[model samples]
Each structure stands twice: as C-alpha cells, then as structure tokens.
Target: MDINRVSARNVHQAHYELIVIGSGFGSTFFLDEALKHITGRALVIEWGDYQPWAWQVEAQSNSPIAPESTYKNSGNKPWNTTIALGGGTNCWYAQTPRLHPNDFKTRALYGVGHDWPLGYDDLEPYYCRAEQIMSISGDPDIGKVLPRSQPYPQPPHKGTSVDALMKAAMPDHHFICPTARPRMATANRSACCANARCSQCPVNAKFTAENGFPSLFSHPKVDVCLKSEVRTLEYSGNQISGATIASEGGEYKVFGDVFVLGANAIQSPAILLRSDIDYGQTGRGLHEQVGANVEVFLEGLKSLDGSTITTGYNYYFADGDFRRNRASCLVSFENRWWPFGLRKERGRWDEMLSLSVVVEDLPNPDNRVTIDPQSGQAVVDYRGESSYAKAGIEHVFDNLDKLLAPLPVESINSRIWRPTESHVQGTLRMGIKDDGSVIDQNMLHHRMRNLVVVGTSSFPSCSPAAPSLTAAALSIRAAELLYS
Candidate 1:
C-alpha cells in the first residue's frame, strides 16, 4: 500500500519474459497465468495504485463508473481512470456471468460484427479455470446457459433482508436466481463470510487483483511495479524491445522478449497507437455491449430481504427478439440498497426490491471509444437510441408484471445513458482481413510477430454475457500461442 515508494525509475534495468500493461481483469488474469506457466521474469506495469491519496479517494467515492475510473462518472464526459494496484477489479461488483453460446457468432445471426474465431467449447475449460481462480460459487442449473465442467469452488453467499422480502412478494418470479459467487480475500482461503460490509471484505471473497495477484508479488519470476506508466514502446524494427515507463520520480526503458497488451479496450489500443505500431485499423470498430438498469418500484413493501447472490433470471434467453431468444436478464435486487450495507446502517430497510433488467444493444460504429483529438485523452462517443434500449426494458417489465399480477409494481425507469461497461471489446477487432483487424485468430498482431494483443478488445462482437471470464479464457489461449 506504499503508493509513493514504487517509482518508475528502473525501467532500463528491468527484464521480463512478458510485459503486461494495465491492471484490469484481463491484464491481471493473464499475469496470473504467466506467473504459473512461464516461470521466467515477468512484470506488470500498472498505472494506478491501491491506496489513493485522501483527495483521490474523496474524488472517486461516489462515481457511477464505480470500479473503473476513480474520477469519472459513467457518462460521455472524460474522467481520471484509476491507477491502482488491483486496477478496476478492486471495486467491481463481482457478478460473473458466462456469455451465451450464440454470442460467439453474432455476425452469422445479425450481420453485426465478425464472429469470434473461437466459441463456447473453446473457452469452456478456461472459463472453469477462471471461475476456480476467482473462487466462484452458484447453483448448477439457474439458467439455460452456463454449462460448467465442474462445481463452483465455493458456496453461494446468503442473501440480505431486502432480498428475502422480494422473494416473499414474488414467490413465483425468478427475479433472483443463483448469481455468481464473489471471490474475496479471506484468512481461511475458502468462501467469503458475506458480511454487510463485504465490499470492503475484511476477508477477501470478492475476486480483486489487489488481493488475487498480490500473492504473486513475492515470486521471483513475477515483479509487480505499481505507479509505472508505460509512456511508449521501445522497438527494434517492428518487434517490441522494451518500453519507456514514466513514474513520479523519473523514467527508464524496460525490455521484454515478448509483449502483451491487456490494457482493456481503450488504454490497450491507445498504447499501440502511441507506439507508432499500426496494424491497419488500430482503434476502429470498437464494440461495447452497453447496459442499462431498468428498475421497477413495487408499492407497499419493505426493501427486499435475501442473501447476496449473483444469480439472475435470463428471460432474454427465451425471448425471440433480434434473432436471439434472450434479450435481457432480471437482476431483482441490483439497485436494491440493503445488501450494499450502507443503506442498512442508515436504517432504510423499508424500501422495496428494485428489479434491474439488463439488455444487450445492437452493435454500431457510432458508439465507440476513441482518443480525443483536442484533449488528446480517451473519450467515449455513445450515440445509440435510448428508445431501443427501453424496448428490452419494457419487455422485462411486462413479464414481471404478469408473473406477479397483484404485487403492486408500478413505474419502470431505464437509466443508463452511457453504460458502465466492464465488458469492453472490439477496438482492435480480430478478423480474417488485415485491413480491418489489429490481431489475427492466434492473437498475433497483423503487422508485428513478437507482439500480441489479447483480452475482450480483440473480440469482434460484444457478447451478451459478461466478458471477464471469456477474456480470461482468451488469455489462456493467447499464452499458448505466445509461448509456443
């Protein structure tokens, strides 16, 4: 937690078998893999720190963007993204849901983006590995999708008081199904205690890089240097020789035989562009599966009272909309306040269970993440219609109303203009043609042989399910291709 001491002054002397940028789920997962598999010198360059200054903490306390950037809201405006040791995974709401099988081939069905080179079968093993790594727990059969190879490593957390109330009101509605079990830091190394202040898990049940990857910091094969911002790539010809890192004290060049960019969709592509390493469409064709919480307020009920769970009912999987049966999922207590613990301390348990319907958006080029020319900073240009998004909202609301006929539910509101996307994909899209993609199926850069690009950003289509598990799945594949 010593943020001020880990300076970027020793980049020139640093050596690694692999150099990873950013500290998000994608980057952290890959680094975890390298630590186990590679066995040589590996270093992760994280832009942020675990403990921000008092001012930084105050600035990032209430952001809708929540886990990603400490300084920004979940909107079109630019904000200071976090540079913590754990990255955004530190503050993320660990709700891991698998992508539907059809999500892998959206192009064949809807002609939107290119189909993923791989599919569910290809990722299933890694998905299981990732779930185990994160210590996921859930019911075996909560939905139509998610065929697990093994049982969850842990048991489901108990729901809160508000969750219990919702279950009582809508006894038949599968508003809250078996949600994903969160991975957190714990002394027992088993499951989380699932306490009220679980977000700040005294025992780490939530899977965070802060707690997960830090265990590897002592390994000689792994070196995690925080506060190290990669300025540019040091290349010999087209291959990356090393990278220039700028920190609080000074800057130096670090070299690696192989380089992997796992800086999420925006920062990853931005680093490539800044390195003057263009593989055709460097940052175009970005696709983020935008999400909005369509909340329905039920009259005359206390807040839902149930144990915390990541299980959700995928009504969309059966709905025949946009060529896919699934249109959205029901998150019965997503915005519900009691389980979050803060509202409970304030004695606000009289609230009703707020249902959140999550829907997937049609991919369009108009919605993208790009580097702003004037400010030279990353900017998100989201221009999809809120009306189309509401269609899914309406769809979910109608079903909930029918199921709980006399539950006195009224007034549905869809409020996610610029969605908080943990599943960011597409920017350096993968495809057959070099003119359109930055990397090929093997995750090799179209232009550079030694350089590899992994993570959700390479996915041609943004899948409906969350991308963290899938991204880890892809990283498992990428490591093989890189080391082979």
Candidate 2:
C-alpha cells in the first residue's frame, strides 16, 4: 500500500482506470474498495490542501469557529463543510446512525418523497464493512430502531456522568448513540480522552479518512493529487472522457476510463451544471434537517465533562405514526460547554446543558441549487417546507417536561432555526427512473455510462440519522458495481 503522490505539473501519465474527485468518505471508501479489484491505476484529486489533525487542532484551538471556506449561497444559508483531505470527516462529530428500515421506502410508506432505488438490506453488508473500517463503537442492541445484520466492531463508548443521569431520568428512552470514535486504543490512534473538541481531535482518536483509510493513499494502485480542483467533466457522447482540472500551475485534462463525482452535495452539482449536461434532475431536491437547540440550567448537575460533544440520544420521537402528517426528530444531549467565547467559572459552567433536536425535512424539488448564469456560482434557492418540521419541533417542546421530569430544571431557552446546511442531500438523487433521478440504483449517471455520482447528493431522502456512514456504505456499493 504505497501510493504515488504526484503534482499536476509532474503527471505525465494522464490516463487512469478510475478518476475519483474529492478525498472524503465518498471517494476514499470507493478508492479503498476499488483498489482491491482493479489492477489499473486510480487517481484521487482533492481541491483543498491536506491539513493534518495536529495542524487543525493548533489552528482552530482558540477560535470559536473552525477556519474553513464555504461555497457561496445567494439564499444566505451557508454550507458548513471542509475541503481538506478527509473532507467533512475532519470536522464532524462522528455520530454514525444507520437509517431506519422505513427510511428507504419513504415514498411507499409516507407518500411524500421518492423512495431510494435500493433498500436497507442492499446496504447492510457495506454498512458493516464501513463500520469495521471506521472502528465504530456502539451498543448494537440499542439500535433496535434500525435493524442490523451484524454487531458493531466494538462495544459502545462509555457515556459521561450526565448521560447516566439522563438515562436514569428517562428509562423508557434509549440514550446511547453509535459513534466512530474509538473507546480504547486501537490501531495507531489513541482512545477518546473526552476533551470535548471532537471537531479537532488533538490525539487523532477520531476515525477520519486520513487515519481510518491510510491504505487508500498509500496503495500503489492509487495516485492522489492535492490542491487539484476538478472544474468540469469532458464528455464526448454518453461517456465522460476526461476531467478538466485547475491546479496552481495551470489547467489540464486528465483522462479516465470511468469518472466518479464525490465532491459533496454543493460542489458535485455545481460541477455537473458547469459541464452543461442537463439531466433535468441535477441540483434539484435540495434539503437539510430542521434543527432546534434547547439550552437549560441543570441545577447542581455537572455537564460538558464527557467525550468531545454528543453523548446521549433520545430516539423516542425518531419515527412513529406521526410520519403520516409531519417529520420525526431525534434528540441529542450535547456534552460541550456553551457561551463559547467568554471565560466562565468551571464550577458554574458545568451546570449548563444543551439539547439538540434534529427533525427530518422532506425533499422539495423547488428548494434546489442553481448556478448563477452571470456569476457562475452555485445559488441555493432553498425555501424550506418547514411546516412539518415545525410540528415535530412543537411535539418535542411539549414533551420536554415529561422527558426531563426526574432531572432538576431551572431555566429553559428553546430556539428553532433552519439547519446549518451541514447535512446537504437529494441534489443528484438516486432513484429507479432516469426522468426523476440524476443517477440510478448503482449511482451511475442515467445518460453517462462512465459517470458515477456518490455521497449525500445521491440520497433520495434525508432521514433523521447522520448521513456519513450511509454515504460511506453507498460509496462502497458503487465501487463494487464499477469494478465488477
């Protein structure tokens, strides 16, 4: 597993068996799987420079917000993402929950959004593979809401004292959250020290693409180019011939047998739109989860002493008969101290607790990303269909007292707003029909045989669960299809 790292200026061999854009979970997982089957060379082009965890920790330590550039959005809602080597995994909190079985058949069951071309059973094996690679630790039995064929690689990470208290208070609700962070030292990475800054794990304990799948970069079959931005796909008829890439030196076309777009929800569609290949479905069905934050003063109770950020989950409201009318939500207990800027007394600050409620938003085709004709920037015209989400939020607020009855509650501040657009999905969605979807069940473009799109963009619908694990699983499945 020794990869050939090359600069755009030195790349004499332009042809590759596979060309994957972006080094995130979408492309990296696919590269790891594709390397085993394909003997031919594969190229992974990343737009951003490689930033190690050590460097990120030092750079983002003092700042409340991490240093990162975002894609322009005319709608004022910015996409919260990172373009580094590991992509969003470098900045994510690593809460990996498999989508519930019902999530795949949302159209059939709820009669709202389009159903996924493939079902949960189709992705279960790949999910296991991704979990093993990521060293996911969690109580498999606790994920009863989402059935799985196999157990997790490791047992659930130990919850903080506050989590225990919450569990004790709400015995009926499941509180454990499946996470990618290692419970104990394994591989070369250290165990989670509960530093409460998972966004920039100083010890590299979190399973980012760089640490989790090092072989993808080190493999002899793979050649990764950093700071190479793939501008557009060069297509002849029904196949993508090459990719026009913009590097620091100059623009160059890199030919490949097959091209995969793993550049995330925003950039992926932007690339497709820029290529002038209108599938009629590109940049459509854009949506994100409806998120609300509940700040409370836990009298005499101490919090923010746990591992990184999230510690517990209340899945009581994730799904139910309520899906017929509105979206369902999952409540997460935040284990990080608030009032991020000002210095606070350690003893007094421990009394603060934050509860995050994430409600599922139905995919609306009208709420989409369109490239500005003049500026050439991706403009997200997202008018959220939040009535359903609002209903769900109201339900959560009504049950707050009942859920936290056993615990001491002093003051509560509940605020609901549109999500930070972190979990972008449904732009280049996957479905059974070519007329409705950008890609098919295999994530291959409907019109272009050699073009495949991966990542959250291929998600038919956004569920309440965090989408990274599912995205990784989908990427692996697509890789298997491509190699076979």
- Whole-model Cα lDDT of every candidate shown, in order: 0.58, 0.79
Q: Write the per-residue lDDT of candidate 2 for residues 1-484, one digit (tens) a residue.
A: 2446788766644899989898777888887888889879888898877776667889873223332333555566656767767788888888988888888887788776778889989999999999998988876656566677788887777666667877776655665678888887787678887776788887888888778876668777788888788878889899999888888879888899988899888889988998997795899888878787787777787767665467788877877667878887888887765433212557676777788888888888888878778756677787865687778888888888876766678767555554473888889999866558989999899989899898898998878788999999998999998778
Error of 2 at 343 (Å): 13
Backbone clashes, each candidate: 41, 3
In candidate 1, which residue ranges exceed 4 Å CA deviation?
1-7, 52-81, 158-203, 236-238, 294-303, 309-311, 317-321, 324-332, 338-351, 369-376, 379-390, 397-423
- The TM-scores, one per candidate, come to 0.79, 0.92
lDDT of 1: 0.58
Per-residue lDDT of 281 in model 2: 83
Residue-level lDDT for 52 in candidate 1: 29
Q: After superposition, how far is residue 116 of candidate 2 from its true place, in Å?
A: 0.9
